[model samples]
Target chain A: MKILVCISNVPDTTTKITFSLDGKAFNTAGVQFVINPYDEYALTRAIELKEAQGGSVTVLNVGEADTEPNIRKALAIGADDAIRVNLKPTDAFLVSQQIAHYAQEGGYDLILMGRESIDYNGFQVHGMVGELLGIPTIAPAIKLDVNGSTATLEREIEGGKEIIEASLPLVVSAQQPMAEPRIPNMRGIMTARTKPLKVVEPVGQDAKTSVQNYELPPAKSGVKMIDAENAGDLIKLLRNEAKVL
Target chain B: MSVLVVIECANGEVKKSSLEAASYGSKVAAALGTSATAVAIGDVQANALASLGEQGITKVLLDNDSRLHDFVAAAYVKVISKAAESENSSVIVLSNSNIGAAIGSRLAVKLGASLATNVVALPQINGSSFTVRRGVFSGKALSDVELSSDKKIIAVKKNAVDIETTAGGTATVENFSADLADADFATAPKETIRQSGDILLTEADLVVSGGRGLKGPENWHLIEDLAKTLGAATACSKPVADVGWRPHHEHVGQTGITVSPNLYIAVGISGAIQHLAGVNSSKVIVVINKDPEAPFFKAADYGIVGDATEIVPKLIEAAKALDK
Candidate 1:
C-alpha cells in the first residue's frame, strides 16, 4: 500500500500578523512558520496508517523553495520521502490541479490532506482533487478505519456526525481526534537530513483566482471592564447595552 | 442567464444560512438583470419553499429525494449541476457550509467554474472580471480575489450577508428532478447521530462557553444552567475538549468548529490565538477569568476578573431572575 499526504506551511498560531508593501502581501519578517496544525493531524494520521498497514508515506507541498524546511520537518515526523511542486501556490484551483497531476502519475491508493489550510482556509483542494482524479472524497473526517479495500470514515454534519464508507483510491480531508501528531526526535531529525526530497515543476492549469488586495480586520476597541464584585451588573449591560439577550 | 442558489433543508424548513444564500443569489440575479432560481434537495414544506420570494427568488425547484434527506455528496452535485445547466446560470451560490463545501468544490471542477469560499461580500462584477472579498488567514484578514472565469461559484460565509426581505412576494414552486442514479448514492452516509435537544452551536444566537478553569467536568452544570437559562448553546476551548473534559463537538477553536454567535460568554479559558480565531467573529464577547492578564480579555467587549466556579453560578442566578 502507498499513501500520499499533503502539508501546508503557515505562520505559527502565536505569530502576530502584519502586511507589507502597502498591505499587498504577508510580511514574514521575524515570523516563525510551522506546519498548519490541521495538516499536522493529517500527516500524523497518514503515518499511523502506513505504520499499521505496512506502506510508504510521501509528503507533498505546493509552495516556493523557502517552504522546504517545513517539508523536511514533515519527513522527520515519519514521512518516508517528500515531493515539492516548485512554485508559490496561486490559488486553490491550481494547487488542486498540481496535486491531482502528481497523484495520478504516482498512482497512490490513499490520499489525505488537512481539511483546510490555516493560511488560505480555502477548504476546496481535496474535493477539487477528488473530482479532478474522478475518485471519492471524504472531507473533514474525524475518524477513519481501514479494512482491506474499504475505508470507513466519520465526518461531522450540521448538528451531527455521519458514518461513510468508500473504496480504495480515495481522498480524505482529515481533522483532529484522528491521531496524535508526533514530533521529530533526535534520531528521526538526523535521518531526515538524507531523506529523498524531490523538486518537480508544476503541471496543468493556471490559477483561476488572484488576490487583488488584502486588509486586516478592524482592531478591537478596549475592553469595557465590569467589576467581578457586582457580577449581576453584567446582565443589565448585556440586555440594555449589548442588547444581545 | 440566471443565478442559481442551492439550499439545504432538514425536517421541513430551510437553514438560516440557506436563506442568506437565497437572499444573496436573488440580489446577484437582480444585479445581473436576470431571475434567481432556487434548487433545494431533501424534505421541505411547500409553504416554506414559497416564502423564498421574500429573498427575491423568482422560482424554486424542489427535488424531494428521500435519499437526499441524508446528504449524498455525489447526488447533491449532480442535482445542483443539472439545475444550474437548466437555468443557464452563470453564477452559483451556496452557504459555506460543510455540505456546500463538499459539493461546491467538486461542482466547480465538474462544471469548470472558478470557485471561492469564505466569501464575505457580493462580487464586484466588471464586465468579465469578477472580484469578491473573502476572509482568509483564519479570519484574521480579508483578501480581495478576482475570479477570472466566465463560470463562477461562491460559497458565502455563514452570517456574512443580511437577509433581504423587501422582495415581498411568493416564489413559484416547481417540482424538479435530476434522474439520480444508484452510483450517486454510493457515497451515502450509513448512519447519522445528532446532538439531542440543545441549539446548534454554529446557529445559536447566544453561546455560553466554559474552559478548564471550571476545574472538572462535573462542574459543567454551571455552563448548562446558564445555557438553559439564556436559551444559548454551550462550547469549550480546545484544552477543555482535549483532556476529555467535554465532548469534541463542543470544542470551539480554529481546529474545531468556528462559530459566530451573537453573544459569546467565555469563562475560564485563557484566550489563545487559535481559540480567538474561531470565536473572534462573535458580535458581543464577555470574558470571566480570575487572572486579569488572561489574553481573552483583550478581545472581549466585556470582561470580569473572577473564578468561573464562583462567577458562573451567580451569573446563572442573575440570568434566571432577569427572565422572570
Candidate 2:
C-alpha cells in the first residue's frame, strides 16, 4: 500500500496577517511558514498506516523553493520521499491539477490531504483531485484504517460521523483525531537530508477565480468590562445596547 | 437557462442549509432574470420538495434514488451534473457544508465553472463580472474574489442568508433519473453509524461550545445541560478534539464544521482565529471565559469574564426558567 500525502506551506497560526503596500496581496515579509496544521494530521496518519503495513509514504507540495523546509520536515517525520511542484500556488484548481497529474503516474494506492489550507481556506483541492482522477474521496475524515486492499474511514458530518469503506487508489482529506502529529527528532532530521527530494514543474490550469483585493477586518472596539457579580448586566447590554439578541 | 439549487434532504424533510441554499439560488435567479429550479436527492418525499417554493424555487427535480440516501460523492456528482445540464443551469448554489464543499469543487471542475466556497455575502454583479466577499484567514480577514468565467458556483455559508418562509407557495415536483451505472455505487458505504443529537449544528437556533478551558472532560456535563435547556447543539474547539477531550464531529474551526446559528455560546474558549472562522457568522456570539484577555471577547457580541463552572450552571438555570 503506497500512500501520497499532500502538504501546503502556510503561515504559522500565531503570525499577524498583514497586506502588502498595495493592499492587493498577503504580506509574507518576516512571517515564518510551517506545514499546514491540518495537513500534519494527514501526513502522520499516512506514516502510521505505512508502519502498520509495509509501504512507503511520499509527501507532495505545490509552492516555491521556500516550501522545501517544511517538505524536508515531512520527510524527517517519516515520509519516504518528497515531491515539490515548483510553482507559486495561485489557486486551488491549479494546485489540485498539479497533484492529480502526479498521482496519475505514481500508482499510489492512497492519497491523503488536509481538509483545507489554513491560508486560503479553500476546501476544494482534495475533491477536485478525486474527481479529476475519477476516484472516491472521503473528506474531513477523523478516523482511518487500512486492511489489505480495503480502507475504512469515519468522516465527520453535521451531527454525526459517517463510516465509509473504499478500495485502494482513493483520496482522503484528514482532520483532527486521525492521529497525533509527531515532532522530528535529531535522528530523523539527519536522515531526512539523505531522503530524495524530487522537484517537478507544474502543469498549469487556468484559475477560474482571482483575488480582486484583500482587506483587513474592522478593528474590534476595546473590551468593556463589567463586574463579575453583575453578569446579568452584560445580557441586558446585549439585548438593549448591541441589540444582537 | 435556469439556475439549479441542490436541496439536501433527510428524514423526509429538507435540511436547513439546503433551504438557505435555495433562498440564495433564487436570489441569483432573480439577478439573472430567470426562475430557480431545485434538484432533490435521497429518499425525500414529493410533498417535502414542494415546500421549497417558500424559498422561491419553482420546480423540484427528484431523483428518488434510495442508494443516494447515504452520501456517495461519485453518485451525487453524477446526479447533480445531469440535473444542471437538463435545466441548462449556468449558475449553481449550495450550502458550504462538508458534502457541499466536497461535491461543489468537483462539479465546478466538471462544468468548467468558477467555484467559491464559504461565501458570506451576495455576489456583487458588475455587468457580467461576478465578485464575492469570502471569509479568509480563518475568519480573521475577508477577501474579494472575482470569478472570471461564464458559469459560476457559489456555496453560501450556513446562516449567511436568512431563511425566508412564504405561505401557500408550492413548487411543481417532477421525477428525474441520472441513469447511474453500477460503477457509481462502487464506493458506497459498507456500514454507517450516526450519533444522535437533539439539534444539528447547521440547523440549531442556539449552540453551546466548550474549549480546553473547561478544565477536562469531566466537566462537560455543565455545557451539555445548558445546551439541553436551550435546545442547542453541543460543539468544541479544535484543540479539544485534538486532545481527545471531545468528539471530532463537535469540533468547530477552519478544519471543523463552519456553522452560523442565531445564538452561539462559547464556554471556556480562548477564541483562536481558526475557531472564530467557523462561528463568526453567528447572529449573536456569547463568550464565557475567566480570562479577560481571551481573544474570543473581541469578536463576541457578549462576554462574561467568569469561570465556566460557575456561569454555566447559572445560565442553565436562567434558560430553564424561560418557557420552552
Candidate 3:
C-alpha cells in the first residue's frame, strides 16, 4: 500500500492573527508556524496504516520554501519521504490542481488530508482533487479502517454520521477522533534529517479567486458581570435585553 | 441568466440554513435582474418546495431520485450541474454544509466556476468585478475575495442572512431529472446514524456549552439541565471530548464545529483563543466560570463568576420560572 498524506503549514492555533500592511496576506514576522492541526490527524493515521500494512507513506505539501520545516516535521513523525511543490497556494482551485497533478503520477492507492486547512478554511480541496482524478472522495471522516482491497470510513454529516465503503485509490479527509496525532521523539527526529525531501516546481494554473483585502472582526463591548448568586438575573437579561429568547 | 439555489431537505422539510441560502440567492438574482430557481434534493414534500417562495424563490425543481435521498457527492454534483446548465445559471448558492462543500468544490471544477465557502454577505458585483466577504481564519477575520470566473458558486454560512418574506406567492414546482447513472452513486453511504437531540448545534439559536470546570462526565447533567430548561443545544470544549467525557460531535473549537447561535453560554471553560475562534460571531455570549480572569469573559456580553455546580442549577431554575 502506498499512501500519500497532504499537510498544510499554518500559524499556531494560539497565535494572534494579523495581516500585512496591505491586508493582502498573513504576516509571518515573529510568528511560529506549525502543521495544521487537522492535517496532523491525517499524517498520523497514514503512518499508522503504513506500520500495520507494511507500506510506505509519502507526505505532500503545496507551498513555498517557508513551509519546509513543517514538511520535515511530518517526515519526523513517520513519513518515509516528502514532496513540496514550490508555490504559494493562492486559492483552493490551484492547490487542488497541484495535488491532483502529483497524485495522478504517484499512483498512490490512498490519498488523505485534513478536512480543511485553518487559514483559508476552504473545505474544497479533497472533492476538487477527487473530481480532477475521477475518483471517489469521502470527507471529514472521523474513523477509517482499511481491509484487503476496500476501505471503510465513518464520515460526519450534519447532525449525524454515515458509514461508507469504497475501493482502493480513493481520497479521504480527516477530522477529529480519526487517530491521536503522534509527536516526534528524539530518535525519529534524528533520522528525519536524512530523509529524502524533494522540492518540485508548480504546475501552471490560474487561480479563480483572489483575496482583495482582509478585515479583523469587530471588538466586543465590555461584559456585564452579574454576581454569582444572581445567576437568575442572566436569564432576564438574555430574554429582555438581548431579545434572543 | 438565472440564479440557482440548492435546497437541502430532511424529514420532508427544507432546512433553516437552506432557507437562508434561498433568501441570499433570490436577492442575488434580483440584483442581477433575473429570476431565482431552486432545485430541491432529498426527501422533500412538493408543498415544502412550493413554500420556498417565502424566501423569494420563484420556481422550484424537485428531483425525486431515490439515490439522492442520501447524499452522494458525485450524484449531487451531477444534479446541480444539470440544473445550472438547463436554467442558464451563472451563480449557484447553497448552505455551507458538509453536503454543500462536498459538491461545491467538485462542481467548481466540472463547470469552471469559482467556489467560495463560508460566505457572510452577498456579492458586490460592480461590472465584471464580483467581490464577496467571507469569514476566514476560523471566524477571527473577514476577507474580500474576487471570483473571476464566469460562473460562481457560494456556500452561505448559517444564520448569516435573514430569510426574505417579500416574495409571498407559492413557487411553481416542476418535476426534474438529471438522468443520473449508476456510477454516480458509487460512493453512497452504507448506513447513516443520525444524532438524537432536541436541537442541532448549527440550527440552534441558543446553546449551553460546558468545559472542564464541571470536573467529570458525571456532572454533565448540569449542562443538560440548563439546556433543557432554556430549550437550547448542548456543546462541549475540545478537552472534554478528548478526555472522553463527551462525544466528538459535541466538540466546538477551532478544529471542531463553528457555530453562530444568537446566545452562547460557556460554563467552566477558560476562553482559549482557539475556542473563541469557533464562536466569536455569536450575537450574545455569556461566560460562567469560577475564575475571575478567564479569557472568555472579555469576548462575552455577559458573565457570571461562580462555580458551575452552584450557578448552573440556579440558572436552570430561573429559566424554568421565566418560561412560566
Candidate 4:
C-alpha cells in the first residue's frame, strides 16, 4: 500500500493573529509556523501504517518557497519523501484538485489528510478530494486501523462517534488518538536531509473564491472583576445585567 | 433562480444547525430578491419538514430515502445537487457542521461554484461580485471572501446566526428523489454511537466547562452539578479530555468542537488560545479560577479569581435560588 499524507504550515496555535496590507492579507511578521496539529496526527498514523504494512509514505504540501523548511520537517518525522505543490493555496477547492491530480497519478492506495488546516480552517478538502477521485472519504476519524485491505475507523460525530469500515483506495481526514505525533530525532533529521524533495507546479483548476479583505475580531472590552467572597453576585449580574441566562 | 437550503434531519427532527441554515438561506434569498427552497434529507416527519416554513422556507423537498437514514455522503451530495439544479439555485446555504462541510466542498467542485465555510454573516451584493465575512484562524479574525463564480455556496457556522421564525407560516412539502446507486452507501458507517441523555455541546445554548483545575475525573461531580443547575452542556479542555478525565466528545477547542453558545461559563480552566478559539464567539463568558492571572479572565465578560471548587457550589446555589 502506498500512503499519501498531506500537511500544511500554519502559525502556531498561540500566535496572535494580525492583518496587514490594509486588511487584505494575514501579517506573517514574526509568526512561527508549525505543522498543523491535525495533520500531525495524519502523518504519524501514516508512518505507523507503513511500518506495519511494509509500504512507503510520502508527504505532500501546497505552498511557496518559504514553506520548504516545514516540508523538510515533515520528511524528518519519517516520511520517505516529499512533494511540494508550488503555489499559494488560496482555497479548498483548488487545493483538493491539486491533491486529487497527484493522487490519481500516484495511484496511491490510501490518502490521508488533516480534517482542516488551522490557517484556513476550511474543512472541505477531504470530501472534495474523495469526490474528485471517486473514492470514499471518512473525516475526523479518531481511530484508524488496517486489516488486510479493509480499514475500520472511529469517526467523530457531534456528541458521539461512529465505527466505520471501508475498503482500500479511500481517503481519510484524521484527528487525535490516531497516533501520538512523532518528533524528529538526530538520526531521522540527518536521513531526511538527503531524502528526495521534489517541487512540482500546481496542476489544478482555478480557485472559485478569493479573500477580499481581513479584519481582527473586535478588541475585547476590559473584563469586570467580581470578588470571590460575593460569588452569588456574579449570578445576579448574569441574570439582571448580562441577561445571558 | 432561487436559494437552496439543505436541512439535515435525524430521528424525525431537524438539527438546530440546519434550522440556522434555513434562516440564513431565507434571509439571503430575501436580500437577493428571491425565495428560499429547502431539501430535507434523512427519515423525517412530514409535519416536521413543513414546519421549516417558520424559518422563511417556502417549499420543502423531502428525499425520504431509507438509505440516507444515516449519513451517506456520496448519496447526500447527489440529493442536494439534484435539488439545487431543480430549483435553478444561484445560491446554496448549509450549516457548517460535519455533514454540511463534507457535502458543501464536493458540491462546490462538482458545480464549479464559489464556496465559503464558517461564514458568520450574509453576503454583501456588490454588482456582480458578492463578498462574505467568515471566521478565520478559528474565530481569531474574520476574512471577507469574494465569490467570483456565478454560483455561490455558503456553510454558515453553527450558532453564529440567530434563528428567525415567521408566525403562521407553513411550507408545501414535495416528495423528491435522486435514485442514487448502491455505490453511494459504501461509506456509510457500520455502527453509530450516540451520547444519550446529555445535551449536545454544539447545539446547547449554555455550556459549563471544566478543566484540570477540577483535580480529577472523580471530582467531575462538581462540574456536573453546576451544569445541571444551569441546564447546560458540559465540556472539558483538551488536556483533560486527553488524559481520559472526560469523553472526547465533551472536549472543546480548536481541535475539538468549536462552540458559540449564548452563555459559556468556564470553571477551573486556564484560557488556552485553542480553547478560546472554540467559545470566543459566545455572547457572554464567565470564568472562575484560583489564579488571578489566568488568561481566561482577560477575555471573559465577568470573572472571579477564586477556587472554582469553592465558588461553583455557591454559584449553583445562587442559580437554584433564582426560581425562588
Q: What is the interface RMSD of each candidate, in Å?
A: 1.1, 2.2, 0.7, 1.1
Q: Predicted chain A of model 2: TM-score relative to the true chain A?
A: 0.97
Which model scores highest in lDDT?
3
lDDT of 3: 0.93
Which 10 consecutive residues of model 4 chain B have the lowest summed lDDT?
Answer: B247-256
Q: What TM-score does structure 1 among the candidates reach?
A: 0.98
lDDT of 1 by residue, A1-245 (tens): 78899988899987777887687889999999999888898899888888899989999999999999999999999999999999798799999989999999999999999999888989999999999999989987999888888999999888989999999989999887887889899998998999999999999757888998888888789898888888988988999898998
Distance from true position, residue A4, model 3, in Å?
0.7
Question: TM-scores, in order shown?
Answer: 0.98, 0.95, 0.99, 0.98
| Candidate 4 lDDT tens digits, A1-245 | 89999899999999899888599878899999999999999999999998988899999998898888888898899999989999899988889889999999888989999999887889989988998898889988999998889999998877678899999999999877788888899998898899998999898568888898888887679889999889989889998999877
lDDT of 2 at B222: 90
Question: How would you encode candidate 3's per-residue C-alpha lDDT over B176-266 as one tens digit per residue?
Answer: 9999999889889999999875689988889999999999999999999999988899999999999999998889999999999999999
The CA root-mean-square deviation of candidate 3, after full C-alpha superposition on the true structure, stands at: 1.0
Could you tell me the lDDT of residue A96 within candidate 4? Answer: 89
DockQ rank order: 3, 4, 1, 2
Pairs with backbone N, CA or C atoms under 3 Å apart (clashes), candidate 2: none
Best by TM-score: 3
Compared with the true structure, what per-residue lDDT tens digits does model 1 show for residues B1-324?
A: 889999888779999899999999988888888999999987787788998999989899998878889988889999999999999999999999989999989999998888999998988977777899998888777899998878889999987788888656899999899999999898788899988998888778899999988989999999999999999999999999989988888899878888878899999989999899888878899999999999999999999999988888788878888954
What lDDT, from 0 to 1, does candidate 4 have? Answer: 0.90
Tell me the spans in candidate 2 whose CA falls farther than 4 Å from its real position.
A221-226, A233-245
User: After aligning candidate 3 to the native by TM-score, how far in Å is the CA of B301 from where it should be?
Assistant: 0.2
> By the lDDT metric, which is better: model 2 or model 3?
3
